[model samples]
Target: MSKLVSENISTLRPYEPGKPIDELERELGISNSIKLASNENPLGPSPKAVEAMQSLLAEAHMYPDGAAFRLREAVSKKFDIPMNEIITGNGSNELLTLAARTFACPGENAVISDYGFVAYKIVLTAANVPFTSVPVQPGFEQDLNALAAACDQNTKLLFLANPNNPTGTYVGRKALENFLKEVPPHVIVVLDEAYVEYADADDYTSGLELRGLRERLLVFRTFSKCYGLGGMRVGFGVGPTELIDYMNRIREPFNVNILAQAAGAAALFDQDFVERTVKANAESMVLFKRALEDMELKYTPSQTNFLLVEMPEADKPLGGAVYQAMLRHGVITRPMAGYGLPNHLRITLGTPAQMERCVGALKAALEEVQ
Candidate 1:
């Protein structure tokens, strides 16, 4: 065998996604399983998106438009940003990786919260760029002041996941604005609003509202979460046109595939689907919290579709074993060992019946272990 692999990738661990339905079914000889592990929509993809993809299938033989011009136009109009300021990616994950490559060099560094999104560290590691992760506050809230302290001249980017993943905590508009105000001009803030749509804080400011600070912040949004198109992996970033121009240079011409582009554009206008998803997710969150309260279990309050529950016991396959047991009972939730929270699990809020299954399975799993 030839030793041709780059050292960066040779030892790097790839992102391990949750077990699929087929794999679980094969292992346990069970069928008709429900997966809330991946944070997918129980209501399914938008009808508009489905119809759009169907119409575009016949054109699959042709190469996709390199720039994704039409989709950019729709995004710009919807977000009220200029078309030149946007860069579409396969998903927000791709954009995160691309940002590392575009801005940070071999010796430069990026700053992030210690318990933040897994990809922030993964992408930096994969790129061979140094990174510093400041620990969060006791309640898993981002310490923006600590982030400022962590950065120096080498820090090219700062990733802030509002309504942060796994933890699902968010800062109000005033807090974020204050953080941005103190941010140095040299560093670009990547505000990841992947779960912002589900965040119902009255004072929360949409990342789109920060367009005036284009040079200092780039806001990343996904069609995957609120729009229900995770399988297609569609997302975009709005920011400084000059910065986007440089990043777009490194992107694959057809990074956002034709089908995803078409579907995403259609889904953008499917307000009915979005409204229904937002409403159902709100109800599910309340239901879960009430169930946990009744059971006397402790859980973090979340503005997003998922919640982080403190187990205070079990990690990994033990935590994951609990996740497996849940599968056997026709429910699936995500273990957080991979995210360095060995004692916590992230459960996506589902439809009413699905939430009921999740709660029942979780209680049984804990009792079984106890």
Candidate 2:
């Protein structure tokens, strides 16, 4: 093997996505199984987006606009940010990678919570950059104070999930403002809001309002969440024009396909559908909480689309047991042992019917084994 390849590539562990419905069904030898594993919109892609993409499918052979013109303009207008401040990505995950490569270098480091979005950590490692992992507070909340304390002169990047994946705990606007006050000028913070549309708390930071301070803060969002364009693989980042412009130079010219560009632009205009998804998430999260409470299962109060349920000490591993049970019952949920939460599982908020079936399956699974 050529020594030209960086050793960083070998040590990196690949990301494990939520199992696909077909794969699960084929493995289990069943049909009509419901998936609550991926934090995807159970409502599927938006009608408007789907229609737009279907029309553009014939042009698939054509290269995508590297600039992602219309989609960028749509996102900029929706958030009231300048066109110059936005950059599109294959997905927000690629944006995270771009940040690590654009800002941090071999000797530099980034700061991330111990159990934050897996993408941030994965990206940092891929760039061969060192990072400090701050432990999440009890109930999986980001410990901003601890993270602040962890920062040193070598730290060039900071990554956080607004409503963290798996945990779904959010840092309020006031807290974020306070933390930003002390954030060093040299340190750039990337706030990943993959599920921002689902957050209902009054104190939740939209990352939209932080545009004025773009020099130090970059807000990442995706069409994959409430916008229902996950299949299109479209997402964008907002930051100070100065910083975003620098990252833009490194992006592939045809990174975003024409269909994704078209669908993303249309999805932005589908305001009513977006509202409905957000409303549904808010409503279903309430029912999920009530059901967990009724069953005496301890779970963190989530403002995001998913709920993280903590399991009790048991003979079998929490990840293996609940996952197997849910699979057996045709309800798929994510086990988060990879983020170091071996005792917890992350369940995405599906449709009301799906949630009802999932909870029932989970309860039955617990009963069957324990």
Candidate 3:
């Protein structure tokens, strides 16, 4: 098996998603567990999206439009981008993989931050392309300058995530603009804005707004986080028409299912739900942050719907142990050992009531571990 497999694929360690509530409850012999590990929308999908999917249930036997025409039209109207420059995917994860496969080859490398999304590394490795993981600045912020410096003639791609996952840090608009200008024209920058809707920071601008700065820039957005369509698995990428065309060539037919297309299209028009969701997240985030302050825990101030919290430095267990203890209390949160922050955890903001419950569980867990 090893002989038959490419070395890059053979040595790869697959991305691990957060633990599920059902699996945790079954293993612990408990019930009513709440999960805050994955940055999921707690308010659920929009009524319009649900209605659209429900309307299409009888047509399940038919194949999805391979071109994703309706969804692409909705996206175009919503984002003011041309439909010809858009490509839909099963999820934005698929688009990332497609970009890696389409633009990169063996001996040509990609660039990413050490604490960037794990999926970037996975996709590049799966494509047999090596990547340079630039060390982040203090406080886990991506070092855009260093990342730009790391690129050379061999660099073909660069993956950047605004309000980056597992850390929740973001680069300001001016910094990002400068970084984009500094990167060589040969490198195609993949700007992933999966949490763009949740970001309330005035200085944080979406790459969609800066597409003209770099000819090779590709911006990826997802329905998973803000639209609550994670289960449906719908996401899309917008870029240069030629780049989009190349990715489309390699995209599987019916990459996004029929229900996902309908749901995503309807969700784009349901801005009311998105606004309500953001408002609720803001209120709940205050409560969550207050509780963390009361516990004297340090956390990275986030622009998105989650916080990256550090464990107490003295006389407390590491993230993994604290995570296990919290599980016994029926609250599931993500530990950050895989991202090399062994003492930190990434927690999603939930409803006020859920956050209150989660805070109590976390306090108890921290006490037990101490």
Candidate 4:
């Protein structure tokens, strides 16, 4: 069995997703648990998306359009990008994997922020493409300068997550623009903007707005966050036609399922729902920050729908213990141990009431764990 597995695959560590609410309830023998672990849109799916998906339930017998025509059309209209430059995926996760496999050859490698999305390392390694992790700056912001300096001719792909997960830190427009210019021409930059909709920062510029800055740049987005289509797994990438064409060559046929395609397209038109989701996230974020402040818990300033909260010192209980204690209180949060931040937790914003409950649970958990 050992000899059967590829050396790279054998050594690779699997990604641990957040515990699902149902699974937690079953294991803990509890009911009505609130999960703030996976950075999901607390509002759930859009009404228009539901209607569209329901209308297509009868067409389950037929395979999805392999090209994801309707969804691409909607994306194109929404972003003003051409259809040929858009590539759809099961989720943006799949697109990240595809970018790794399609661009990086055996000898070439990719580069990512140290605390960037874990999926980048997973996908790159799984594709047998080596990568370098550039350490984030003091504020947990991706050091764009260091990342640019780390790239050599062998660097084929560079993965950057704006409002990076597990930390919720972002580089502003000017910094991003300067960094893009500094990157070598041969390296293809993959900008993951999954949380772009929630960012109200004045200087935050989506990679979609800077697509013309680099010929090889690709901007990937998902309906999972703001659009509330996590279960449907709808994601799309915008890039030059040539690059997108190359990626499509290796893209799985019917990757975007029938229902997902319908749902994503409808979700695009439901701007009102997205606006409401953003508003709720802002309100909840403020409440959570205020609570954290009152508790003397340090937290990162976030431009997205989640907060990265630091626990007590290493001498005290860390994120894992706190997470477990919180679970006993019927609240599920993401522990940062796996991401090498053993003393921190990543909490997704819910409704204000939910945040208050979460704050109460956190206080109780701290008392119990400490």
Kindly give the number of clashing pairs for every candidate.
Answer: 1, 1, 0, 0
lDDT preference between candidates 1 and 2, better one? 1
lDDT, candidate 3, 257-298, per-residue tens: 999999999999998999999999999989999999999999
Choose 2 or 4, whichever is better by TM-score. Answer: 4
TM-score of 3: 0.98
Tens digit of per-residue lDDT, candidate 4, span 1-370: 4488897899999999999999999998999999999889889899999999999999999999999999999999998988999999999999998998898887999899999999999999999998899998897989999999999889999999997897888999999999888899899999999999998899999998887678889999999999999999989999999999999999999899999999999999999999999999999998899999999999999999999999978685489999999999999999998889889999999988789899999999988878
Misplaced by over 4 Å in model 2 are: 1-5
Candidate 1's residue-wise lDDT over 161-249, tens digit each? 99898798998888787788777778889999999889888988876796565467888999998899999999999888888998999
Q: Give the distance in Å from residue 68's predicted Cα in candidate 3 to where it truly belongs.
A: 0.3
- Each model's lDDT comes to 0.86, 0.85, 0.93, 0.93
User: How does candidate 4 fare on TM-score?
Assistant: 0.98
User: Between candidates 2 and 3, which one is better according to TM-score?
Assistant: 3
lDDT of 2 by residue, 1-370 (tens): 7686677888889899988889989998988888777788878888899889989989888888788889988988887888998999998988998999998866789999988888777898889998889987877789998887788988999998888887888999988887776677788988899988888788887777865553588989999988887777889999988889989988888888898899889988998898889988888888988988898888988877889887766876676687888888898889888987777889999988988998899898888767
How high is the lDDT of residue 69 in model 2?
82
Best by TM-score: 4
| Over 4 Å off, model 1 | 1-7, 312-318
